[model samples]
Structures are given as structure tokens and as C-alpha cells.
Target: MKAPGNVIGFPRRSFGRASAGRSEPADATDEMSDRLLAVAEHGDRAAFAVLFRHFGPRVRAYLLRAGGDAGRVDDLLQETFAAVWRKAGQYDSRRATAAAWIFAIARNRSIDAFRRERRPEFDRQDPAFQPDPQPDGEETLATRERAESVRAALAALSEEQREVLRLSFYDGESYAAIAIRLGIPVGTVKSRARLAFRRLRAVLGGRREELR
Candidate 1:
């Protein structure tokens, strides 16, 4: 099973390149993982199917642990595999656990699913209503403003930086996928992304002083 923190780009894949060779003990799952990654990278449907059978349960389990609604978990499970299809080339086993990468991807997919459907069903005296009045206040406004500042800072970045940031943050792309899509080295991709994040942090600066 994928461990945690995956960032799949497309649907199922023929295992692609990244972790060409890492010093790790040989095991059944690892061996299967290697094959799954290679064939999946090439868009082999059969390979993708194998991957799904092996890893899909793990992804589903992860979602369940995260408090996923049983009704929608199945749908999210399919979406996570789809992401794997488009991003097989980005799996660098050396830099990340195959399991962890898969986990992260599934987690991101679940969160994205929620965000896409997130909206309060408003109705007077609704069953979901809470007793807390004046919940929306200046504090909430300030927090939102800080988020906007971060978004603005991201917008100010170089096109490549912004793209990577969005894929990494919103789309749950790993450094490897960002490199493949951007035609840059993984190191360069990570460095650029780091710089972007740092810049955003500075732009929204405050020791809980100004922006805070």
C-alpha cells in the first residue's frame, strides 16, 4: 500500500522512470511496485489495472481514516488512480516512498473532491445550524486577507514557479511531476518551488504584528 503524501498527475500508467535504482531490500511489494511503475508510465492499461488492484485498497483505506464519507469514497478512489496515469513519469522512488507517494496522491484527491463540492446548504433553522452567533467576525476577515496575500504573492511569481506551486499545492504534484511537465531537472523544480513558498511567506510577513 502507498504510505502517505502522493501527488498523481494523470490516470493509471505503465510504470515510468524515476527510481531507476535505489538501495533497498528486495521484497514482493517492492518488486511489484517496480514493474507497476514501469508499465504504468507507458500508459499500459493492463499494468494500470494491476496497480489499481494492488494499491487502490490502500488509497481507499487512507481516505476512510481521514473521515471520508462511505458514499463518496469509491468515486474518490477512481480519481486517485486517474491521477497516477498522468504522472507515472514523476515517481522517483529514491526521493519518496512509493507507498507514501501514492498515499499523498490519494489524500490530495480526496481533499480536492471535498473542496469541489464544499458549500453550506443554507436554510433557516437548518439541522446543521450551530448556536454560535457572530461567528463571522474581523478575525475571520483578517485570516482570509492573509490567505489572499499569499495567493497574490503566488500570482507575482514567474510563470513556471506559479504553475509548479499550483500543481504542487492545488493539484498535489510532486517535484518529479513538476520537472517532467516543465522540462526542468527535479533539483531545479524543488529549488524554484521552495523559493516561491519562501517569497510568499515573506510577502505575507508579520510576527503576528502587521498582517497578523
Candidate 2:
């Protein structure tokens, strides 16, 4: 009962076309935000506190919609403000209102969290931080072969399987967030992630040891 869309519809048989009529809280929020930014930019902690008090719940709601946890919302909220403090100068009215910018930051942080989780972990050579080196020529061949096998297995999976895996592993999103985003049941997300991981195990067998 939904229309096909190269522009919008999902590329699979499952998820229905999302409604196109949802409105943003942008305009109603911008006025308060601009003033707050101006005050906070001048190092007004009281004003900054006011802004945070007012906007904190809004930001939490926004982040939740973007796939975040209730438990971690406070942590993310703190990070969002810290970012606002550091990047106040980056706010450009020509693009977005202050609230919109803040909201966008929250959304981007959510996505960035996803992107970061997709990367291989760093090693601790200096007891601080260091990037892991990539495989060399001969080792690269074996690595590439392994990558190919993973890709092939992933390619052969149902779209549902691949998507759940991507959201969990690649996006670092939780089951609830994935369910809300995909507009499916929470149980469905959990089940699919489980099924996908199982299939991945079947595909990789002993070679999946590196992931653990």
C-alpha cells in the first residue's frame, strides 16, 4: 500500500515508505536559541545554563529519535554542550538557526558515533593512543581475501539481515533505536540482528576470531 521511489522508498521488500509530512521543530526553537548563542558566546554561564536547562530535554528527544539510549542521553547531552562551547563561532545564521544548528550537531554526533564504531580499534603502543598499521604486501593479500569473503557473505544475506547488522555493528546503535528508525517492532530488530550475526558466524566459521 505504498508508492515506489528511486528518490525515497526503501530498496527492499520490508520497510514501508516513510511519511513525507513530518515537520521540524526548527522555527519555534530558533528565536530562543539565537539569543542563547549570543549570550553563551560572550561567556555567559548563567545564560548558558538557562539555554541548557531549556534545550536539554529537547536535545535528548532529538537524539533519541536519531537512535540513542535513555541511559546515555545525559552523557551525550554534556558532550553536546561542550561542543557548543568550543564551536560557538561555527554557528552561521546564513545556514541554520541556532537551535537547528544545535539539533544538527546532535544528529551529526549520533551519525559520527556510528561511523567511529565501524572502524577497527586503536592500539596502545605509547600508553596513550596509536593507530594500528594496515597489512603489508603479502599480508595484505590474505586480508583482502578475508575481506572479500566477508563481503560475499554479506552480499548473499537478506537485506533485512544486512541492515540490522549494519545498524548494530557499523552504526553502534541499540535495538530500540534501530526499531524506531526502521519503524519496525523492537523484537524484529533484535531477532534480525541475532539472525544476521548467526549467519555471519556460519559464513566466517573459525576465521571470525579476529572480531572477538
The residue-by-residue lDDT of candidate 2 on 1-212, one tens digit each, is 22223223212211121122125333233344444455545554554555676678888877676566777766787888888776776665433455656776676666666445553434344587653344344433332244446678899889988998877765558899889999999999999988888887787654346434
Which consecutive 10 residues in model 2 have the weakest lDDT in total?
12-21
Superposed by TM-score, candidate 1 places the C-alpha of residue 82 at a distance from the truth, in angstroms, of 0.3
lDDT per residue (tens digit) for residues 139-187 in model 1? 3333224434555787899997888887786555678977898888999
The TM-score measured for candidate 1 stands at 0.40
Report lDDT per candidate. Answer: 0.62, 0.62
What are the runs in model 2 whose C-alpha is more than 4 Å off? 1-30, 115-212
Off by more than 4 A, model 1: 1-27, 115-212
lDDT of 1: 0.62
Question: In model 1, how many backbone clashes occur?
Answer: 28
